[model samples]
Target: MPRLQGVDIPTDRPTAVSLTYLYGVGPKTARELCLKAGVDPVARARELTEDEVARLAALLDKDYTVEGQLRRQVTQNISRLRDIACYRGIRHRRGLPVRGQRTKTNARTRKGPKKTVAGKKGVKDLR
Candidate 1:
């Protein structure tokens, strides 16, 4: 594995694919990085030379907000929203879907497991 920006990219995959392992670098960005670094995007990560790795790392550091920095920036943005108590901020604070997703169904990922309420009594049973 090649360590770039404090993350270990998979050596078994192509360099472009491996670069996606780093936070905030997706396929398009990975290809761009390979191009910018003058490294072969299709080359296996394990086959990259030390100088090539250094160029990739340097490019990432200089041109991109990635890894810990990106994580911190996102958290900070959310926290700022929370502090302002906007609708979106409230959603974030409450652990609900923030993107106008219908919470009536299919929000299990954000809403967690269902907490079923007790069924209402039947009219006959109440009588």
Candidate 2:
């Protein structure tokens, strides 16, 4: 594995694909990085020379906030929202969906496992 921006990228994968292992770097960004760095996107990461890796690191540092920096920025943004008590922040605080997804169903991912109420079985007798 070749290390870039303090992260070890997969050596067997294509350069563009391997770049996606870094935080905040998607396929599009990886493609752009390869283009700007003049590195071959289809080449395996391990095939890259030290010069190519240096160029990539320089480009990443100059043009993008990635790795730990990106994660910190995102966390700060969310924390700022929470501090302001905005709707989105409130959702974050409550651990609910923030993008207006229906919570009545299909939100189990955010809502977590079901907490069954105890009285449902006896409700039929009352009725």
Candidate 3:
């Protein structure tokens, strides 16, 4: 496996496809990166030489924000929503859907499980 930007590249796949394993990097970005670094997109990750890896890493570091930078940006986006205190912010705080989707039916992933309540008449007298 070739390591780039502290990530293990999948050696069995083509460079263009394998590079997508890195956070925030997709197929297009991977192809562009390989081109910018003078790497062959069709080559397998394990075929890359040490110098090629170094070149690719340098090019990526210069042109893109990966790993920690990407993570921080995502965190900042969520934090900004919370700081704004808008309807969306309230939804985020409450762990509910923020995109105006109807909660009467689906959206189980975001709304979680429903609470069951027994009807008043269903209760029997213990005395």
Candidate 1 structure quality by residue, lDDT tens digits, 19-61: 9999899999999999999999998999999999999999999
Q: Rank the candidates by TM-score, best first.
A: 1, 2, 3
RMSD in Å for all candidates: 3.9, 3.8, 4.1
Off by over 4 Å in 3: 110-127
Lowest lDDT sum, 10 consecutive residues, model 3, at 114-123
At residue 122, give the lDDT of candidate 1.
Answer: 48
**Tens digit of per-residue lDDT, candidate 2, span 1-22:** 6798889999999999999999
**Compared with the true structure, what per-residue lDDT tens digits does model 3 show for residues 9-55?**
89999999999999989999999999988999999888999998999
Model 2 residue 45 lDDT score: 97
Assess each prediction's global lDDT (C-alpha) against the native.
0.92, 0.92, 0.87
Cα displacement (Å) at residue 22, model 2: 1.2
* Candidate 1 segments exceeding 4 Å error: 114-127
How does each model score on TM-score? Answer: 0.86, 0.83, 0.79
